[model samples]
Target: MAETSRQIPERIPVNLIVNGNRRTLDLAPWTTLLDALRDHLDLTGTKKGCDHGQCGACTVLVDGRRVNSCLTLAVMKDGAEVTTIEGLGRDGALHPLQQAFIDHDAFQCGYCTPGQICSAAGLLAEGHAKSTDDIRELMSGNLCRCGGYPNIVAAIQQAMAQS
Candidate 1:
């Protein structure tokens, strides 16, 4: 008889600056950032749509850049700053983009709203989008099943103009 040995996964420490707060978590190396945010930190606004990188529902900002949380491991983001839907607003006030979303009616069912908003923020910060076509092209990664592309583009454009 032959005996086989199985290796056990170990929990590793990860330090993240989430929503302006430093959060230290012990997570398995395989734990995704989406799981860490939704499961461990209780930040559920960042939705899990496809669970794959194909859908941008789990999009979040890591160090001011947009990222697919489901595609990246939490351990890989150690010491990085992470921002979710919950972090966009401040002092009980909505961010300009959030307000623009509401004013433009950019969401319908709202499942993909968070990711769309986050991606828009990143796009705005990148300062490359100059027209509606540019906004649409840049925001193509974040899909809205509700077919809210028109309003989404308008909202982003309004927000960009205001900023």
Candidate 2:
């Protein structure tokens, strides 16, 4: 029995603060945060693209900042607060940014929508620069290959103006 138990790999325990909730999980050390969120906890709002951190598609907010989940190790984020696109809404109401995206037509194909939205949320929280140029510069990390940049900018600016 001891030998049989030793044959099974052990999962590393981690505490994740996700969307304002604390969760403890036993996961493989090699798992990425992306997989932990989507596969384990069922937060599917963060998209996986390129899987190499080049597409900026797996963006999520960690401790009120944006990061590429595909590049982040699950075990390394122990007790770190993580927020996905799902966290932006409240009680079935759409976040203003979400509404703005809809109003401005900020997405097509929609595969990149989650990353774009989450990145914009983090951008607004930073409050570093106000000009469109600055927004463009800060948002450079997130890419929308579907040519949704203009509308995405419009939606972000609109939400900023409202907030």
Per lDDT, the best of the predicted structures is: 1
The C-alpha lDDT values of all candidates are 0.95, 0.90
Give TM per candidate. 0.94, 0.91
lDDT of 1 at 87: 99
lDDT over C-alpha atoms for residue 55 of model 2: 83
Worst 10 residues of 1 by lDDT: 4-13
Q: Which runs in model 1 stand beyond 4 Å of their true positions?
A: 1-9
How big is the positional error of residue 89 in model 1, measured in Å on the Cα after superposition? 0.6
Predicted candidate 2 versus true structure: per-residue lDDT over 1-163, tens digit per residue: 4554344456899899998889998998888999999999999888889999988889999998999999999899998999999898898999898999999999999888888889899999999758889888888988898999999899999999998
TM-score between candidate 1 and the true structure: 0.94
